[model samples]
Target: MIAVANLAWRSVLNRKNTALLTILTVAVSVVLLLGVERVRVQAKESFANTISGTDLIMGARSGNINLLLYSVFHIGNATNNVDWKTVKDIVGQPAVKWYIPISLGDSHRGFRVTGTTTTFFEQYRYGRKQLLSFQQGREFDALSDVVIGAEVARQLNYKLGDSIIIAHGLSDQSFTRHDDSPFEISGILNPTGTPIDRGVFVSLAAIDAIHEGWETGTKRATGAAFAKDYTNHEPTAVTAVFIGLKSRLQTFSLQRQINEYRFEPLSAIIPGLVLRELWSMMSVAEKTLLVVSGFVVFAGLLGMLSSLLTSLNERRREMAILRAVGARPHHIFLLLVSEAGLLTFCGIIVGILMLAVLLLFGVPILHAQYGLVVDVWHITEYELSMLAIVQAAGILIGCLPALSAYRQSLSDGMTIRV
Candidate 1:
């Protein structure tokens, strides 16, 4: 067995160029296969961990996905605002513990502006029930103060006390700007790898104070003084509300009551369930990517098979020499199989190194662009199973060429084919 392995190693080195190319092909395929799986798993984890400790997310009547997108993700505008009276009535229930009302529809240089109370900083939890912490300064205290997320602060180069003007709507180039009421950067949050990292938070009263004369979508030029006393300013409506229950057992009951409320059209959703439903809807695309990666791996294995089969013709005389030297027919088969196994094993090692380098550099980019935190060194059971399957397939593929070589050795024993 050792002699056959040594001979196989020498044979592969004799055609070093082709062997290297085949290894590279296999390595690239492995990288793609493993990379897709890693990202898929990490993305689901990031999505699920985006918001936690909140029992329910309530907003104007809309689909669960829509409510999640607008309220939690700040992805789109809400269909309608939940009246303050309705919001108060819902939070006043005996089952409710704490509630944070969020108002949207404002932007500052493409970053979303969220209007909520200081309770948001205290009550909002993410990633294993972690509370929000400031990286630079304290939370907003004055009406003109604003708290920016990590990405927002980094991208905008905002420092504490830098005043930023917010636009009237979500557009980066809005025609109506709230120039008269600029907000001072009071705090910057630590990176959470979630939508919170891209948001600009302010008091809900600030949302109302900025739109004092913009009832028609355009700010009126009236020389009205901007309200400084947030104590007197109150928001009449909000885009959505994040609710926490006194006891988790009352979550479903309150959800049912809110959904069936006759005073207003409302939708209440559990974040985890909606996220699961969203992932289910997106699973088709995920599976499609995985299938494409599988085909790529198959193509790489086929390339290896082609290389082995092509080398058989050139090595016909070599096989005759081995057979004349008292080597058995099974020895030739083992030699070929050993060569394929070595190539696959080496390719897997190289692929893992490549994946490590990729994750090392890609972690920051993914977190910055999509708020996805990918672990560099975590290998799941599924990935190990994939590697095992690839190894088995490679050895099986080598059988065809190995059998051909075995038969040639028998027919052309002790004689050169040429």
Candidate 2:
């Protein structure tokens, strides 16, 4: 067996170019397979970790996905605004521990502007119950004060104390700008790698203050001076609210109560459950990617099979010489099988190395662009199992050429075909 293995090694080295190409083909396939799996797992993790510690997200009556998207992710416009009176009544519940009112429908240079209370800075939590902290300055205290996120500050070149004009609508180019109510950047939040990083936060009063005398979508000529006394100006409605309960056991009851509220139509959703639903909806795309990768791997294995079969005729004289020198037909069979196994092993190693190198450079880019943090060093059980399956399949594929070599050796005996 050892002699056959040594002969197989030498034979592959003799056809080094073809062997290397075959290995590279398998390696590429392995990279694609493993890369897709890694991204799928990490993307889900990032999505789930975007918001935590909040018991429920409450908004005007809408689909669970729509409420979550518009309220938490700032993805879409709200269908309707929750009455501020309803918000106060719900948050005043016995089970409610803290609440953050969210008022939207404004923008600052393409970044979503969120109107919330100072409690937002104190109560909002993310990944592992992490609290929001300031990288510079402090939370907004005054109506004219605005707190920008890390990404907002970085991308817009904003600094604490710099004045910014808020647009009336969410569009990047709004004609009706709130030029009268420019806000000063009072704080810059640390990056949370979530939608929070892209938000511009201000007091709810600020939201109403900016839209003073605005009727419908256009500003009316009130001719009155912009109200600087924000204490009197209050938001009559808000886009949504984030609520935390004193105990998680009461989550379902409160959700039911809020959903059945009589005064107005409303919806309450558990963030974790809604996130799971969103991920399940995306599972079809994930499965499609996996299937495509599997096919690539199959094609790679077939490439290896083709290489070995094509080399068989060229190595027939070598096999005959071995037979004359007392090598058995079974030895030729073992030699072909060992050659295939060796190529596959090398390919797997190269593929892992390639993936590691890619992650080393790709992780930062992904995090910067899409807020996805992929752990490169962690190797899951699934990956190890996949590699084992690939190796076994390679050995199985080798048997075809091995069997052919065995038959050729038996028939030719010590005769040199050429």
Candidate 3:
């Protein structure tokens, strides 16, 4: 078997240039197939890691997915806000460890504004209990002070002490700008590859103060000079409350309590459960992408098969030369099959190496644009299975050329075809 394999290798090397092109075609396909698979796995991982350590997300009664989308991902708007009294009542639960009351419905240059206390920095966790760290400066010291996420600061070119205006709503062209209540950047958060990287954080009191004197869909912002004291009238409502349980065992009990609260209709969800549900809803689209990639790989392999089949015609004399050396018909078949297997094997190797290189260069861009963190150091079982299937398909396709060469070597046997 080993000697037969060597003969196969030598024959392929004889047509090195053409073989190289075939290998490259297969390599590109492998890259696309594995690339899609990696993204699917990592996207789920990135989403799941965004809000770890929080036991329950309490918000106004609505679609569970909706509350999650607005409060954590900042992808949508909340239909209703939770009263501050309700937030306090939930926090007062004996099972509560700490809570961050978040108020929304505001924006700065298209990025959502998150209003919470300094405790937010300490309590909010992501990517495996990772704490939020400041890239520069410190937490906001006053209501006029704001903390920007890494993306917001970079994209908006904001730095410490840079003044920023808040809009009354989420739209970039909201028309109601809080020009009178400008905020100075106090801090910038380090990149977390989560929603935190895309938000602007401010003191909840500032949220109230900035919107001071506004009522009936009107904004009456107070001057920046006295706006720092706007906390005297704290916000009477918040969009959501992030809750951490005293212990993991009490999470379900507290969740049930929040869901059954009498003051106002409320919904409490486990971030992990919501995340699973979210992915389940999106599984069809994900599978569709996978199927598309599978066809890409098939097309690539078919290209290789065509090259192999075409080369057999040219190599018929070589096949007869092997026959002259006491090489049986099976040896001729193995030779052709081995060449096909070798081409695919090399292609898979090159494709994986290319993906690794891409990941090294793409980490920063992916984090900035998609909040996706891909691991280049590891390959999961699913990836291994995928590679195995591709390799097997390559060997199976090789049989097409193998039988052709076998019949040609027996019949032609050094005789030239006219």
Best by lDDT: 1
lDDT at 324 for candidate 1?
Answer: 88
Better of 2 and 3 by TM-score: 3
For model 3, the local distance difference test gives 0.87
- lDDT rank, highest first? 1, 2, 3
Off by over 4 Å in 2: 1-3, 13-17, 133-137, 150-162, 172-174, 220-227, 232-234
Looking at model 3, residue 306 earns an lDDT score of 97
How do the residues 1-418 of candidate 3 rate in per-residue lDDT, one tens digit apiece?
9998998788778899998999899989998998899898788787788898998999999898998999999988888899988888789988898998999988988899999888899989988788999989999987688999999988988889999888988765545888787898999998888889889998888887767677666756345534354645557999999999889999888888888999899999998899888888988988998999999989989999999988778777777888998999999899888988999999999999988998899977886676677888588898889989999999999999999888888787667673
Assess the local accuracy of residue 263 in candidate 2 as a C-alpha lDDT between 0 and 100. 100
Each model's lDDT comes to: 0.89, 0.89, 0.87
The residue ranges of model 3 lying beyond 4 angstroms of the native Cα positions read 172-175, 221-233, 368-371
lDDT of 1 by residue, 173-204 (tens): 54677878879999999888899999999999
Model 1, position 310, has a per-residue lDDT of 88
As a whole number from 0 to 100, the lDDT of residue 300 in candidate 1 is 90
RMSD of 3: 2.1
Candidate 2 Cα RMSD (Å):
2.7
Per-residue CA lDDT of model 2 for 1-418, tens digit only, reads 8877888888889889999999999999999989998998887787887889999999999999999999989998889999989998999999999999999998988999999999999999987788989989999887789999889998988899999988888765546777767799999988778899999998888787777678677764554324567675658899999999999999999999999999999999999999989989998998898889999999999999999999898888888888888988888889899999999999999999999999999988887666677778788999999899999999999999999989989878555666
How many angstroms is residue 83 displaced in model 2 relative to the true structure, after the best TM-score fit? 2.1
Q: Considering summed lDDT, which 10 consecutive residues are worst modelled in model 1?
A: 223-232
